[model samples]
Target: MVSKAMHRIDQQVPVLPIGDGVARSARQQQRSPYLYTDDEIQRILHAALLYPSPKASWRPVTLFTMLVLAYCAGLRGGEVARLMLGDVDLREQTLEIRETKFFKNRRLPLAPGVMTSLKHYLVVREQAGAPTNPESPLFWSPQRNCGYTVGGIRLILTDVLRRADIKPARGAVGPRVHDLRHTMVGHRMRDWYKAGINPQSKLPYLATYLGHKDIRSTLVYLNITPGLLQDACERFRKNGAAAPQTRESLP
Candidate 1:
């Protein structure tokens, strides 16, 4: 439009800087996800449990449970923050995630170990005089007297990450809270490879487990890490050296 206006007036058209094109291209590329190792996760959990908060007596246990649920359940930060006490069914060992990213609800079964952790947290929370009403927030903050907002969860996790040495204390460039979801997917795929299970066949189930609308969205979270690569290579070699079966022996 500027160039056309200049042409009408018979004036010179100023050239735009080439840097705009370069910046636009950079914006279009997806940032690489940071995958946390099992050891790093343990360290973060330990740090969260030791986090200091003078106002909130239940802070330590709440933060610890929040991180565990986010990773173990492959839940988004908002999903974790929005969880209500009613959504967690200890008897059934399941969590009902309501109104997720795709505006769909999903119920996830908890592993035995995860259920044990939740029970312990609930016990401690009750001792701390936190609310036990079904409509109460699963993880509550004394300061807010309500469920944590998405931003609040991010701020807490950022501090824990810094304390765990998983991220620099003062930098914006580091692993994000959302990376926990990505790490969960990558770890699951690697475990499947190690167990000689066909990960390709499990993709759909994994997608649904993560509350993804399709496998393509889930694929974005599957980072190719060194451990995953090694396991995949080992699986390939084992299959290659296996004895060939006759057509009559095929299942």
Candidate 2:
């Protein structure tokens, strides 16, 4: 096998070309995460709510609730898919995410308004007589008799983006459910800057909130956008912060 040959060559050559090429390819193929503006988020949510009759009649409420949670909580699609009925604590305004990405558990506090919306969704679910057992999925699907699959959610999200008239150019990646997390981070960072808070100091808390094992992992979620860049630069100028001058080392 090529892998075995690579192992053998490692002992002989002290280095491998395969790994370098793969790393280079990965760097070249990396795509930026799509960041949604406030208007775009509202538009997408509206589109989901307006999803056509019949098939989507069963889904509008569920999809809208899911979108709110994804954007507000910055939950990964898989984490959102795995939520159990007992995981959501309306009284405490918290979500218990268990055995997530790194086999870690975390509690995420909800915004007051987001909590209210979730309470409304729960009331509707109860009226519909959807399952309420502890083991039952928080987001139930009438079609699946269980929680929505991550892939299923992604497919639905793609359709919603299309309906919202959001299309990525040719050969470019479009918005996805996961991008909601990125958008959440970006928006939060922008807000922190505007509020005169040091985002760097709060990154550890954000990492914990997002269930990332290390701060390094959380950094990947923070993408720089034009608006974020402009706002940050303006804040810096307002604060009278100066760029550090670099000193050349003597040759």
Candidate 3:
């Protein structure tokens, strides 16, 4: 977790620098991959989303809604804290990010599958007589003034991670929400590749869509795997390039 002191600094820091670091990491890791094995990430997100929790009478709908928004929309923990009852448009199939952690605004396009689930959830919400106003918060917790906190998001997934028994490879960092952001980027890149999309050119669009200030901030999500790394090394040679290496985090 970022200490409040760190958060204050990050808030003041220019986002482009963050993007630069992200891009440099990707370039540096061309020889060695610096990411979870695909299976590990898949296991973590699925387990977290599926793990059952003690639902309030309205929790089933709220929980499902939160999962769909977080996974499909790629919202950060704080943007989610600001989700309002009317921020979502089930009919329009898009949602607006008012103000985000990095101070970027975006409109996340939704697909039909997610829309279907969201509609189901909204119905339950309506049955429970929830609000449909832009003013009212979409997800409220009795404990929080506005919405869920970083710690809350962490606890939610940590409990599920324990259930799934997913651990870091020896000497790897434990998984976290930012990891979910990484996983989503990796998944999208794979999809673009499969669809004959030129990843280099497509990256800017993806960056904008993901609410990144610039492509550099978005490129960190592109750290490749061993097989992809081998392919890069065969074509491009960079002096002193590192494999995607991860430093160990203290337990």
TM-score of each: 0.86, 0.81, 0.65
lDDT for residue 27 in candidate 2, whole number 0-100: 57
Q: Against the correct fold, how does model 3 do in TM-score?
A: 0.65
- lDDT per residue for candidate 3 within 16-87, as digits (tens), equals 334667766675555332345567655654664566645446553555566556656667766766877777
Identify the superior model by lDDT, candidate 2 or candidate 3. 2
Ranking by TM-score: 1, 2, 3
TM-score of 2: 0.81
Candidate 3's error at 237, in angstroms? 17
lDDT scores of the candidates, listed in order:
0.86, 0.82, 0.63
lDDT of 2: 0.82
Residue pairs that clash (backbone atoms under 3 angstroms), model 3? 19-217, 32-243, 32-244, 33-244, 34-244
- Candidate 1, residues 104-129, lDDT tens digits: the string is 99999999988988998888877777
Clashes of each: 0, 0, 5
Q: Superposing every Cα of model 2 onto the true structure, what RMSD results? A: 7.1
Stretches of candidate 2 off by over 4 Å are 1-29, 53-58, 168-172, 241-251
